[model samples]
Target chain A: MDLEDTLLMMPGPVPVAPRVLRAMSKPMINHRGAEFSAMYDDCCEILADVFQTKNDIFIISGSGSAGMEAAVGCTVGKDDVVVTLENGKFGERFKKIADRYGKVNPLENEWGYSFDLAEVEKKLEEGAKAVTLVHNETSAGIQNPAKEIGKLAKKHDALFIMDGVTTLGGDDVKVDEWGVDIAIVGSQKCLAAPPGLSMVSVSERAFEAMDEKGELPYYLDLKAYKKSGDKSQTPYTPAVPLFFGLQEALHIVKEEGMPARINRHATCAEAVRAAVAAMGIEMLPQLDEFSQYSNTVSAMKAPEGVTGNDIKKDMLARGITIAGGQDRLSGKIFRIGSMGNVQPKDIMLTIQELEVVLKKRGVISGLGAGVEAASEVLDSLL
Target chain B: MDLEDTLLMMPGPVPVAPRVLRAMSKPMINHRGAEFSAMYDDCCEILADVFQTKNDIFIISGSGSAGMEAAVGCTVGKDDVVVTLENGKFGERFKKIADRYGKVNPLENEWGYSFDLAEVEKKLEEGAKAVTLVHNETSAGIQNPAKEIGKLAKKHDALFIMDGVTTLGGDDVKVDEWGVDIAIVGSQKCLAAPPGLSMVSVSERAFEAMDEKGELPYYLDLKAYKKSGDKSQTPYTPAVPLFFGLQEALHIVKEEGMPARINRHATCAEAVRAAVAAMGIEMLPQLDEFSQYSNTVSAMKAPEGVTGNDIKKDMLARGITIAGGQDRLSGKIFRIGSMGNVQPKDIMLTIQELEVVLKKRGVISGLGAGVEAASEVLDSLL
Candidate 1:
């Protein structure tokens, strides 16, 4: 099937903006030439502004997982003790990558739960070289306490590495203020670009830590990336078309302004939550005393009458795409993303259609109630 | 520094077809959905036809180096002996990547030189776990002895891995016949698709060999790719739009027919060499006893009076983007790529322009001679 009439609302591979899509049609150029070098440097500057950091930014020609691999593989050397927080699938993935190159002290928590600061601090006190944390766990729709964890790791003299895959651009991420030594984001997330590239911002401290270690995997090695970044080049040929899309997407981010973009995501997320709650549905990782709800993608618990798969299937049939829970959470929760250029009108339509599906599945008794509630939230925002 | 009205004659990141460029502007879709799965499977079938193999094909979401890493990292275990043939930059890169995971016995040869079969057989006879060879060395414009080297590795019971980055689509590559266990090709080369994704074909024997080893890195792991290939998926999110372009590019390849495509590349190479020879310029490698010229890119030695950099600067100033030599070849020679959608007319214009530039630089006595020679070669092909 072609990609003509479908609406992509998954956590990633999000629906790209029209202009950004058009940007990918640009002609190819020499990757090592001045034209590409200029584009590369422009992307780094734009991404720096978006990440709210003065740190060094590298554009890697891989998905978000490759960026995560770089964060783990480059800084954590062999036999080095590293602390990793695993509260969701991506968190566990960080631990897995770190385990490949170093001694990992995995601090496991419940899937829908956020990290416990006390536990993290205690683990850090055991003298780890680096700490890996997920800023926003998309699976559970929880924004973990990266700020506190970053501070703890800083005090412990450990480099703070973060997976900002789903939250960096759609939400507020203060890389420098949060004491994050390394932060990674994907092209298709809140940036509204096509997938294939990952933007990584590395702090000076992180570079120093990496320099102390031996070379990591060739393609995933951040040191090689840094060496090439000094001249606005990558060690290998990058995805040229994706770079064009990302540059245009970053320009759009600048035009809308990061603050307004983050606010829009927050408003859309609130409308979604209000609409879903009106249908008597529960959200996963129901906000606790510590963790906050994710403002990019909302994860809802499947109703008692049907599985998450059923709702996803019905949505797909209607030309809309939402995501079912991953791994153990599969069939338990469905996620609706509000990241990137998802407008209020799109959210209203999604909620309306979601309500129709819920009623068709005999989960909700009333129709239009979810839409009405969402419209109220939308009206307040306007 | 805009990408418009400029010629790209580099080894890769070559000029793309309009249809392939437009295809990249298609809207995004769910990566895990049936639509993407179908597109992925279709791409694999088409790529298998291009690779001339019935082996399992996996589409990776990184550059060609990632595919190379997957080939080396998956099959070569720790302490395993991996014999790598180094004749150019990419060959040296393979050695570096293999050295990361296994015991590498590098058979270093001069750049622009083909592998000595006696030397390769001698190394393979020493009982290695794998042997890495580049099918076409782009940096030196030499097509190496991959077929003979592959047989040597097979005879020694060693897995044969090859870097087919620059030759897969533009030249004839028989993976099974050449005894290549794992072959890698990039999207931006002869496929006429933009860079970002790399396609890999793995033999059953390579799969068995990889199974005997431990897990490779997550993103570059071929096992995960194989598992996902069963359902036409990737372990991580792929570059969605790039895949769209690749599918269309593969369709173009089918329409043109592989034999015609290979012949077109060969004719273009012959015309380039004939034209340069008429202009009194020498080519790199100069035809060794066993090695042949590459059909995709032509490497020309700098004339007596100027360096490769001078020629590159003059061409760039004229809005014609040719490439200077890479690494050690820098300022020593220049490259002219005839791969992808670059047509006979483009080559004709490039040769004509080259003569003008040479005459203006006082490196040649007359104009139009190069184009005259190229036209003769083109007419002979017709």
Candidate 2:
């Protein structure tokens, strides 16, 4: 299929808005100039709103992992003990990054499952300088107990850092209310901006901890970021075009308002689940009370006779790009995104196309069943 | 001035080509997909060619400073001795970065002046794990003694890491032949791509040394980049639109050919010197035999009565942008870029505009003198 007409249905690197893409095409300006300073301040202010935090926020020029790296490396010293929670790919990444800077006490659960908070509290009680969690695990389509973990971390006087990569812009993630010291989000996910920039909000408590820390990585030094950020500058030259795109995307988010945006995402995700259930597809994430199905993406196990890759190929050939499961779950599950600007109509189109692919593979009992079920859900809420 | 009418003549964040800007507006593609793999592979291949090396090259998803951090942190262990040469802002940055990862033996020089090579050699002799130098000091507009320093580094069994940010694409920098173990370049400078990405060329020797190192910065991990580069992927999601812009910029460089590009940059820089000399302006840098005036940027002392910022403001008022001196040299000198797609015509227009600004400020005794002298150089070479 040609790129001009394709629809990206993946959880991340989601379809960018036309104006956002246009913003990226603008000519370069001196990043240290007044124009850049105004733009940088505006973008960071909007990001603080999205994170729902009064804490200091800074933008990292690299991807989401750079944000994660800055959050951990700047605050956790070699002598510090970090309690890392892992259930899926992105969570595992947090653990790996924490392992680099501090002694790690990893608390892991099966992918798509909830963590044992009792065990997490035990680890925190034993002694921890910080606790890290991925709020929304895009890999397994599950939302972790960030609030519960943050409570436990606060109770034990440990810094709480959360990876809100796929959750921040699409859902109501209150960084200050939940007692998160550092919260991170990737630009390309729920923000609908191009991939390349990540934003992190750092609390005063975290800044104090970082001030006591020594010899942080020069590039990901949050203190340097904070110092420059006060003047609306970066420690180094930033990716100018990406900043332009992110600013435009944030403007759109502001115009839509967070409450409406969060409601839309939740409605879209519920519609997808209804459609998949009607198609007799089992949802991939077996989330418990503290956990929930991901609002940004929906993951489901492939039917008995259908291969995930085969379905993906059929959909791609038909001009829709979706993702198959990653790592050990490859070819066993399929995922579709409902993040960013994606709404009820897009979800209906995606489910309708999925029905066509399944029908071609003799795995569908009824052609219109999934779409009809999705339509009912969309009609009831959106 | 409005953005559309403005022309950037600064050393970095130079004016981008129309085609390169267009490339950045393309829709998102899955970074893990085959299409991105193909694009990533092609970009790295072209980068190696521009670097004039067969060494392993990887793109870092940050600015030039991030590339510098990666080059220094990955290879220099905590106990290693790093001989850092600082003559300007960027050189000082290299020293600071090295200090975080290793014990730094700093050799300082005045701004706009070359380092004392004999002193540098003494440090290497005393024992250095690596020798750090900025090939082109963009801030001071001086090219350091990279070739001679590299020779000493090789003789002393120290890794030679050079910041070629302002020189690589627009000059003949033979990374392999010069005995450079790691060479770094930023995309926004001579590459004429949007800032946000940096490329580094690592020799086999540097990789061998890195293999023995521990606890490198997680985000700037060269080993992670190398592992993902083999599969034409990044360790994390890259800035996709910037990659597209860089690929297009590289394509333009390849079409012009490096030799031709280098000649053009040299001629443009020489033409600026000729033009400024005709106006009785003094060059900023005090070059020794081993050191040279920069070919990608020209630094000139502000006329006795004219402050650097006044010239910059006057130029900006006329829809052209130039840079004033930074740090201690602020308001003392101004710099103009001759990098990337800045041709003789752009240089001619810039000087013509400069004459008007000076005449308006009562600083010009003979208007158009700079333009006429620049025309002669352009006519003779290009």
Q: In DockQ terms, which candidate is top?
A: 2
| Whole-model lDDT per candidate | 0.89, 0.91
TM-score of each: 0.97, 0.98
Best-performing candidate as measured by lDDT: 2
Which run of 10 residues does model 1 chain A get worst, by summed lDDT? A1-10
Residue A105 local lDDT, model 2 = 92
- lDDT over C-alpha atoms for residue B180 of model 2: 95
Per-residue CA lDDT of model 2 for B1-382, tens digit only, reads 2647588899989889999999999999888888899999999889989988998899888999999999998999889999999888899999999999889998988989977788888989999999999999999999988889989999999999999999999998989889999999999988899999999999889989988896677889998899999888998899999999999999999999998899989989988999999888899999878999999999999998899999999998888889999999999999998998888889999999988887877777768789989999888556
Q: Report how far residue B204 has shifted in candidate 1, in Å.
A: 2.0
Tens digits of per-residue lDDT for model 1 on A114-145? 67788889999999999999989988888898
What's the DockQ for every one of the candidates?
A: 0.82, 0.86
Off by over 4 Å in 2: A1-3, A380-382, B1-3
Q: Candidate 1, DockQ to 2 decimals?
A: 0.82
